[model samples]
Target: MTVDTAVIATRLSETFVAEVTGLTISPEITSEFGRSIYEHYLDHKVLVFRRQDIDAGAFAGFGTIFGRPEEHHVVKLRHPEQPTLTYLSNQDELGRNKEMKTSGQGWHSDYSYKLVPGGATMLHGLEIPVAGGDTLFADAEAAFAALPEARKEFLRTLRVRHQYRWSPDRTDPWARWQYIGPEERKRTPEITHPLVRRHPDTGRESLFIQPRVIGSVIGIAEMAEAESTELIEELVAHITSAPYVYRHSWNPLDVVVWDNRCVLHSATTKDLDEKHVRRLLRLTTHGQPVTPSMPKVGYSRLSSR
Candidate 1:
């Protein structure tokens, strides 16, 4: 079947995001429609496709339009038949959608801890809560662009370290969860990417820092731990401020995709409970470094190593 249809894109935010309508997704989506979605995705950091009632298999197929779908580090949460699709749910039995682990509560880019971070993360809402379960996104590009030229130049010269499950407060609940094992730790060691990362495809620069998994600036002899922490906090606050953010309140069957290189997203658990189940299928695609080369340092659980 020739799937020829025109997709209508309306701006959700002035420049940060857009909503694409008029295209129904399927495993056999035409290349032309897929290309149009990709173009919108690049132009706007986030694209929301309304009312896509597709299964895990079809969602996995739709993800290929962005790039090769990459398996999330959390293996158990992945769909049984479709390994590339992971469940972001508040339910235990993923099959039943009763409740389990709730992912993306923190403001961070997907897979930023890895040497090669994820390029894009797409989520398809299966079951949404009555009140909350909204996802918030910050436009890193806009945040960076808003900074003074002097500050931008300074950020460009620095590299920030990010580690898996590394939190400033060890008491933080996310750090307490021992989901990432020893071997997985070895696979995802401490890595450093430029503070101001230029999108490889777009050549646009964005502030890149995962506050939840962030560490100090590496290779800076003069910068102390306190100074590094202060800097990270400052930048994270700027990137996540209201001016750059777009809050997405999901409805069932809504498919939302965001650019990881230029967008920081966090999940809200406002009214999520046993009675109100919020379940979404998530897929992230493989990504190369924002810059050509980044230093892959060895493992270290401690904040400073």
Candidate 2:
């Protein structure tokens, strides 16, 4: 169902969801919309726009106003007309179902595994099935703010190890760089970052480390890994707690643009056996690497093939 762009513009609110209006064209309106998106991104980590009739190229055109879109070096499948648009789904064009886990199943920042992670991400839903496949986003800024004073103090001075190749189960070969290439593998297996980071634009402290990718807390006792892991897990739990998050149930023409720097997100499980297909075109925004003095943490450079 198409929505009125004017109505959406008038009623948009910071506390609740708002559908962005206007045809996916017009240079003047698009520029204003891009700035609005940036402001909303800083205020609300998740923003959903419904009924945007955007093809891959059109979506890329809208995305370019915000920032240069980055190609998914690992996810080779992209729209032929728009190379910047990464096709995310469990089905192919011929109506045949492919494997699940097209990229969003886990709770993560877009490319936090990389030395230079993604800045923002735009996902336009082309196809969506019934009853499942909603995306959940957690506000890391809110999560960090809610931490207990003692816990915050402890985390402020710590650093954790992160790896691109790390996964919950050693099943997906694509999850590892060895299967991809040595050049790609160079950035895999490990890097270190602060437990707490100050946002480059906002200068607000946030929980920087994520689970699984973080091997252990640096300079801590080896026997303390279990304790450290438990502590981090609790912190993540606090971050994902309800009221600090929003879930977006999709419609075919829905488009979502999110800031990766301050939010963590994941996709809900869907019925893969019923020939259900969920197709989305995604473009990522590039971000500068977190600096040392900002947090005084050690980070080793790994290869990105």
Candidate 3:
């Protein structure tokens, strides 16, 4: 359980993931040390730092080492003292789980509909469910690499539109929970991003499909809506295949950082116990707006959202 205070990165799974240890992360940080921590994040798309019983200030500090920590558009869940961290808690007002916790019920890259979708999200586990409530992540890069050459070429030319609002068929409790203010709606609107995203820093091509929030795909003028839906279904299935996936079981003192640009994650909670609740503090690092024109591979056919 206890380890040396010298920074170490240990691979957790066969896929691109590592368990980070031996570093004390705090608000007042050194750039030299932070850069080394970030290098591990770059090498491993997901990093699990365990037994880091740090406060909110320290969590936000670790987040900024990668980039500027962004406030959640959802203002209600934000920590009073720290805007950068959001409390993903399941308890209702009186410390009971009478309400549904919907922050990450389905697989998604955080704030993907935004013009500049967030980059890396770090979550510190304040409390976790014993039986379930694990978070699962899928590697888009590996999924794309496994695709057939013809399918890869076709996807490169396509664009997909993502919307933050729930679909018409989504009659779940989250339909009301996800509501934003009228003025806020203007700030967050449907945006089209390349189906195949080129990572801004690495320039690595990834199968960038946010299945839960996707409204539609453009650029395939001849494709019918029904066929497009089927295609998207297939893409989601392939991207989340077991080979490219890792399921993380949380420990109370564990903190996990996942790159939203390269990974898709979902919380796995089959059922919640009303007796106890799950809670976590999360900080997000914002990335640059995705440019419509991807010049790396010369694929730029897109439609206005």
Q: After aligning candidate 2 to the native by TM-score, how far in Å is the CA of 210 from where it should be?
A: 2.5
Write the residue-wise lDDT of candidate 1 on 1-305 in tens digits: 11224666788885488888777888556365787677667778798988997778888988998888987555776798999998777866654332135456668788776788888899999998878889999998888888899988888888777777766565555562255568876866677777788776666778887564422123222467778878877888998888888999998899999999889998876346757877788899998776822233321211110
lDDT of 2 at 158: 74
Per-candidate count of clashing residue pairs (backbone under 3 Å): 6, 5, 0
**Candidate 3 ranges with C-alpha deviation above 4 Å:** 1-6, 27-30, 93-100, 168-187, 212-222, 291-305
* lDDT of the structure predicted as candidate 1: 0.75
TM per prediction = 0.85, 0.79, 0.84
Better of 1 and 3 by TM-score: 1
Question: What is the per-residue lDDT of model 3 for residues 1-305, given as tens digits with 9 covering 90 to 100?
Answer: 11324468898776678898776667544354776677667667898988887888778777887788988655776788899888777776322243336557667787777778888998899988776788999898778877889988888887776666645344655453245566765766667787888776666668777554432223223457677667777888987888888999898978899988878888865366645568888898887776442665533222110
Candidates in order: C-alpha RMSD to true structure:
7.5, 7.2, 5.9
- lDDT for model 2 comes to 0.63
In model 3, how large is the Cα lDDT of residue 142?
A: 75
Which whole-number lDDT from 0 to 100 does residue 220 have in model 1?
Answer: 24
Top candidate (lDDT): 1
